[model samples]
Target: MALLPVDDALQLILADARPIADIEHVPLHEAWGRIVAEPLIAMRDQPPFAASAMDGYAVVAADTAEPGATLRVVGESAAGHGFTGAIGRGETVRIFTGAPVPQGADAILIQENARPLETTMIGVVEPVQAGRFVRRAGLDFHRGETVIAKGAMLDAGRLTLAAAMNLPALPMHRRPRVAILATGDELVPPGADPRDDQIIASNSFGVAAIVKEAGGEPIDLGIAADTLAALNRSIDAAQAAGADILVTLGGASVGDHDLVRKVLESRGLELAFWKIAMRPGKPLMSGRIGPMHVLGLPGNPVSSLVCSHVFLTPLIAKLVGRTHHVQAVDAILDVDLAENDLRQDYLRAAMHRRPDGTLVATPATRQDSSMMRVFAEADGLVVRPPFAPEAKAGDAVRAILLRHI
Candidate 1:
């Protein structure tokens, strides 16, 4: 079958993917990068009580407005300590930041605007407004309010908020375990002394790294020979490992050595989609065997990485309950593109910021998807849509940024 467009293939894969169940609870400290399974409701109003926002003298605004007015500081209120004394008319209390506002004192005059008469008294140097410098209870957050919503990714700030709300732990989804299996008789593991016909199996490492970056745990299943028995054994091992996702590195095309489709089907797997009309990754395939989602990537180095960026990353995000996940972006093209073929081309390019503050992407000297060195040096993929006529300079183009230029 001919390849489908990239967007169509993505729609098909996403339609079949189910969000993994949220079935784990982790302590707040260990919850970083985890997705919240439930909404985090505030146990108490933030601040819990009315507090002073500054170090100043709390007083009755009606009496403190008269310049040089003297008021006795009934007591001192420091953070974590409440002034039990009440401040009636012509009475005041010395307060510090975070201290609860004393009763009957509706306003505060900052120390810079007051003259200290003693440790317990001060002369008002300026007028004070009612309720000034008082942070009302629940101003930051109300009691029983949802501080963080479900499916939110926990970060340092979110964890701090959860702790502030007295949540000792959070319900989070378990990290998906992904198994990466590289297949090919001509491929050897890294550090092996390869024969002239053999090439180092480097795609697995890249795939595993991408999996980890996408919030999934990658288990490298090592390289499998092109033979059916070897590939079947490798698949069995991956299934036995309880992997949530199984990613095969090669043998997804129609060639005689491309045995991934047949092997997966023989094991009763359901094929979702294959052969996206995207350059460098047109042979990609996705399916499911039992409970495990399978992603078959093209053998070429750049093709594998591109497909990972397009499909695997989103799959991992979906499994972890993450939303709004997308790759980086760039500005419009600086030059024209020739007529496109039937496939979408993800051209490797170097992207940089121009002096005018616009993002400019230039395609690399070599556009071959198998060139690992050039792929490594590229900062993004400049997208070229299929059937597009000649594009002139200044035409808008979408590019997925890979890294800093």
Candidate 2:
């Protein structure tokens, strides 16, 4: 088959993919980063009453219209226990912060502006205005109103708002479970002694980090040797674990030792597409095995990691009902770049901001796919289209940011 364009391959992988419909109810304390499955409705108005915002005396605004006006203090209104009697003309009530505003009292005279004449009377030294220092009913929100829409992520501010809405728990989308398997005869787990010809397995950890950051749970299936039997055993374990997505590293190309697709095909894998038209990730493959989605990533450390950021993160986000995608912002090029290839290129680039606040992206001199250090130091990937013209320093370009910066 002809090499699939990057965009086309992505469309095929998610053509039938839908966000998980399962909903799990969790307490507000455990809700951070989870997608909301239901609208957050307010059970009652915040504060539930017009309360005092300061330690002061509640009096009729007209009664305190003149300076040095003496008013009789009827009773005290504290939080949770409000003064029930009405304040007649020339009358006031002792109130504290958060206390309910007493009836017939339209304003508050703070203690700083009042002089206690005796136990039952107080003199107002300053003129007061109506509705001053009184919090209105339902100022924040009303009862039975939807405060948060569905599909919103429960962040710190949103979670606190939900608590104030009288909700002890919230409905959230189920976290996606991703099964990660590394396949190679020359691979071993980290901290294990590797023969001269072998190297420690590290790609799965990077991919797992991406999965977790996208709000998915990652399950390590360990390293599988090149043999089909070994690969099949790991795949079986993934299925048994009820994994939503199966991610296989290495063994994706057409080499004799590359058996990821062969093993997946034996399990009736419906191949979607392979050999994307992109540099450093040409041998990428994607498909579905029964109910589980499968992604075959390239063996090179940088290639696998870049593809995870470009492909896997969005897939995990979608599975958990979050709207996510790769984004590229325009930046100024800091160096000359040669181009003209059939496949698109994503060059590791460092980002810097000018004193005037303009962003500049400079591609590294070395972009070998096996170098993890280059990828680590890079803040973004400068995207160059297939068969694009050469670019010069100071040219305008677009780059996909690695971090929000």
Candidate 3:
């Protein structure tokens, strides 16, 4: 099949993906990063009653219209111990912040604005308007109102609001479970002794980190040899774990040693599309086995990581009901770039800001897909369109940032 464009490949991958239907009740403390499965209704008014917003005297606003007006201190209202008696004309109640405002009191005369005339009398030096320093009932939210909408991610602010709404727990969507499997006879587990031609496997670790950051649970299926039996065993393990997505590293290309596609097809895998028209990730393959999605990525460390950021992240975000977008912003090129290729390029580049706040991107001299160290030091990927003309320095370009810088 002809290679699919990068955007077209992504569209096909996400077209049928939907948010997880299973909802789990998570405590407010543990709900962070989870997607709300339903609208959160307030159990009661944020403040059950009209309350004081300041430590002051609650009095009739009409009675405190003039300066030096003295009122009898009838009672004290403190948090959790409110004054039950109503305030009459020429009477005031000593009220602390968060205390229920006494009935018949329309305003609060703050302590700084009041002068003590006697033990039971205080002068209103500054007259307070009605409702001043008073937090009306349901000021924050009303009972039975939807305070948090469905599909909202629980962050610090949202969690705090949920707590104040009297919600101790939230209904959240179950995070997607991803199974990672590394393939190839030349690969071994990290820290393991390897033969002359064998290399340590490192792609699964980076892929797992991406999955976690995208709010998906990653299950390591360990490394599988190039043989069909090993691949079939790992695939069985992934299905046993109920993984929503199975990610296979290496053996995606049409070579004699490539067995991922062959094994997946034998197990009833429905092929979607294979190979993208993009550099460092042209061998990318996406398909489905029953209900599980399968993504075959290139063996190169940098290629695997880039594909994860470009594809897997969005798939996980979709399954969790979280909004995800890969933003490519305009930047100035710091060096000349060769052009004209059938495949799109994602050049690892360093980003910096000029004195005038203009962003400048400088791609590394060597952009080999196998070099993991260069990818790590890169701040972003300088995107070059397929078949674009050669460009000189200082030309405006576009980049997808990977780091804060």
Best by TM-score: 3
Q: Give the per-residue lDDT of model 1 (tens digit) for 263-345.
A: 99999889988878889888888888888999989999999999999888888888887753566675767666788899888
Report the CA-based lDDT of candidate 1 relative to the real structure: 0.85
Q: At residue 133, what lDDT does model 1 achieve? A: 90
Question: Candidate 3 — which residues are off by over 4 angstroms?
Answer: none
The stretch of ten residues in a row with the least summed lDDT in candidate 3 is: 320-329
lDDT of each: 0.85, 0.91, 0.93
Q: For candidate 3, what is the TM-score?
A: 0.94
Higher lDDT: candidate 1 or 2? 2
Residues 1-405 of candidate 2 have per-residue lDDT tens digits of: 788888887888878788999999998898998999989899999878888999989988898877678999999999989999888999999999999998899999998999999999999999789999999889899999999999999889998999999899999999999999999999989899989999989999999999988999899999999999999999999999999999999999889999889999999999998899987798898999988999999999999998888788888888988768677888999999997588888999999888998889999999999998999999999999889899999999989998766
Residue-level lDDT for 245 in candidate 2: 96
Work out the TM-score per prediction. 0.90, 0.92, 0.94
Clashing pairs in 2: none
Candidate 3 structure quality by residue, lDDT tens digits, 120-144 = 9998888889989999999999999
Worst 10 residues of 1 by lDDT: 323-332
User: What's the true lDDT of residue 160 in model 2?
Assistant: 91
Residue 310 C-alpha lDDT in model 3? 91
- Shift of residue 403 alpha carbon in model 1, Å: 3.2
